[model samples]
Target: MTSTIGVTDRRALAAAQSSPPPRSSAASRRVTPPRDALSVEPSVVDELLLVCGVIGTTVSDTDTPDRIVPVADCLNWLQDLQRALRRDDDQYRPISLLMAQWKIVPQKLLPLVDSCRYDTDLVLTVAKILVILTKPLAESTERAGKLPIETKTKTTEA
Candidate 1:
């Protein structure tokens, strides 16, 4: 037996056959600003350093250093993570290293809060580092994904 289209089907077919709505003029289309035209926020850096400290603590059981040397030492490992977040570089080994370190002691990052007072731009650069450091590992839950991430407590000497 032959079946006829139902009222709903007819209406849907009619709608499909109908012409599309009027198009906006090309000039009316919205233009996206250039990358350089956009400004990065400062608060992101606070998040960045916090991520880095989490990564650092996760790596080798070292407490957050009052000085920049230890932090700088992490530069090589953190570079990849930085590039991933900052979109400025090609290498990601630094980030890989930071991940390796973080995998060792994942829980250690819970206490060190971000409380830095530097230029918003500078903090953003650092913030980029932190975001790249934690996100990938956070996405994984495999045994091979422990990521050197540790969760512990310690004290630093000045």
Candidate 2:
């Protein structure tokens, strides 16, 4: 899990991320953030990606632990991301495509859910992610489909 930083590294690794302002911050402040404050990063997208990666990897492995504590923490982290995603902010709109690309489907989480059935918080967080992902995605997320294929097939009579 440390290989791909998640909520645990939120503070230490926060300095390097340079995500664009969400629609909520369309009027971004001009004042420069203090250097120490750089570690106080705003975007949770990378954390979300990491959480998904962790869950996906754990699901694929046959010898995964009986209870993945990190996944529980990931659920908490995802809850924060869900809150950010639920806001009526266009800047965060691009994240929908990310969620789709990462395959954050309800079924994708069943393995962990099965392991954590006793934990109500984890169950509810999974439900929240499922509910949020089921909604119609923002138009910008369409780019998630073909972003890798530029499709520039032009032949100049070679």
Candidate 3:
């Protein structure tokens, strides 16, 4: 009887060992971030456009007129929107407006590129428009970054 009990215990132990360990609820509930995680937030748009502005400024400085044009246009657009929203300190409205504009304008603008046979004139025009469109988000993102993380965190926490 002792030997039988020992065999049964060993079998149970072996089976337990072969099976995977149970996961904690937190571990089991782990979620994969969406592929477009950045796009999920309105501020993310501003941040991205801020980076675009930085890139555009760099390109413009480097005298890469062709490449700079597109990047510059994106930057300018973001900056303009930022100015408009901050004009009377009426923030939050610009994000909704800019996002709507981007969705609509890109559809019309993209066709112009192909329609013009991707010529220098057309490229420049697109770049100009993009610069104008990007200005607002860029400035807002810049200002937002200027605030200390601790301040933002504390404000949100409270």
Angstrom error of the Cα, residue 106, model 1: value is 12
lDDT of 2 by residue, 41-130 (tens): 234455555556665344335676544444436666656767755752342344554555566664357666777788788788877866
Q: Estimate each model's TM-score.
A: 0.26, 0.45, 0.26
Candidate that would win on TM-score = 2
Least lDDT summed over 10 consecutive residues: which range in candidate 3? 146-155
Cα RMSD of all models vs. native, in order, equals: 16.6, 22.1, 15.0
Q: Against the hidden true structure, what lDDT does model 3 obtain? A: 0.44
Candidate 1 weakest lDDT stretch, 10 residues: 108-117
Per-residue lDDT tens digits of candidate 3, residues 1-158?
Answer: 47988999999999999999998775575443332321224454555345333423212345433223344354345445345434422222333344444463444445445444456754565555555445564434444333322111112554
Winner on TM-score (1 vs 2): 2
* lDDT scores of the candidates, listed in order: 0.41, 0.53, 0.44
Model 3 vs. true fold: TM:
0.26
lDDT of 2 at 63: 72
